[model samples]
Target: MTNVTYKYATVLVAIQNLRNEGYNVDFNLEENCLICGDNKYTIDDFEIEQVYRYEGESNPSDEATVYGIASKDGLKGILVTAYGAYTDSMSTAMLRKLALKND
Candidate 1:
């Protein structure tokens, strides 16, 4: 995979810009998978297509990350998560796949 870098003024801009780029689905991480409405995707079901990390200048709580994701079955989405220990916990496989985003 090739690396793509983008600079956004804020986390909201990253989310909106990624949506404009066609990552329109909104995802929430469950204990073992990523969920969107009635659909659930396991670790093997999707890949992270892009990542945008934003750091807070005055407060760490403002730090966050935006992920552009696509599933094997043709679903595309976005996942917004916070940095550090406040992030939601994930199953090992799910964690491994998401960690690959940094590579």
Candidate 2:
């Protein structure tokens, strides 16, 4: 993973910036993997290239994170997820994979 710090005004802006840089695919979190269209990728199939987090000014529900992910097969994509109280439920492995970076 790239250990560079990037600052964006909002999660949308971060996603847009990543999209412009060739991370076009949109990935949704599944119980044990990330899904993009018909393709499913496990943690071992992809790497987190970058991560951007946004904390709400007032409501904790507004907290979110944007991830730049790249698959071993050359697929590049973005994954947007909520944190704290609104986090998605997933398998233990999936949670560990994402939570490690979240910290």
Candidate 3:
């Protein structure tokens, strides 16, 4: 993987870890998804949730859409927060897939 990719993956992991740790973000990891902070960060328990693009026309150069599965409580909203190293042009899909396998 490229150095830039390595950096984004790191941040993604950090986000998951933070959720697991019950940080300021409110959430929990389900069997096939993660319900967190008004945002449902969707992904298998083993998958990593993150946007892989290095940059975008969006306000946040580095951004990702997180979704979670429906739970007894209900599915959380969604948050596309700014994060990771914005390189310029990169494969967001490949990066997201790689991020999922990163764990």
Write one digit per residue (lDDT tens) for candidate 1, span 15-66: 8888898888899888888999999998888888887777788998877777
Model 1 regions lying over 4 Å from their true place? 1-6, 85-88, 100-103
Clashes of each: 0, 0, 7
* Candidate 2 local lDDT, 2-99, one digit each (tens): 73344999998999999999999998987688989998998799988888878889987888888899988899999888865324567777776676
Give the C-alpha miss distance for residue 101 in model 1, angstroms: 5.6
Predicted structure 3: clash tally? 7
lDDT of 1 at 23: 86
For model 3, what is the error of residue 6's alpha carbon versus the real structure, in angstroms, after optimal superposition? 22
TM-score of each: 0.82, 0.87, 0.23
Give the TM-score comparing model 3 with the true structure, all chains together.
0.23
Name the regions of candidate 3 deviating beyond 4 angstroms: 1-54, 57-60, 66-69, 85-103
lDDT rank, highest first? 2, 1, 3
Model 2 weakest 10-residue run by lDDT: 83-92
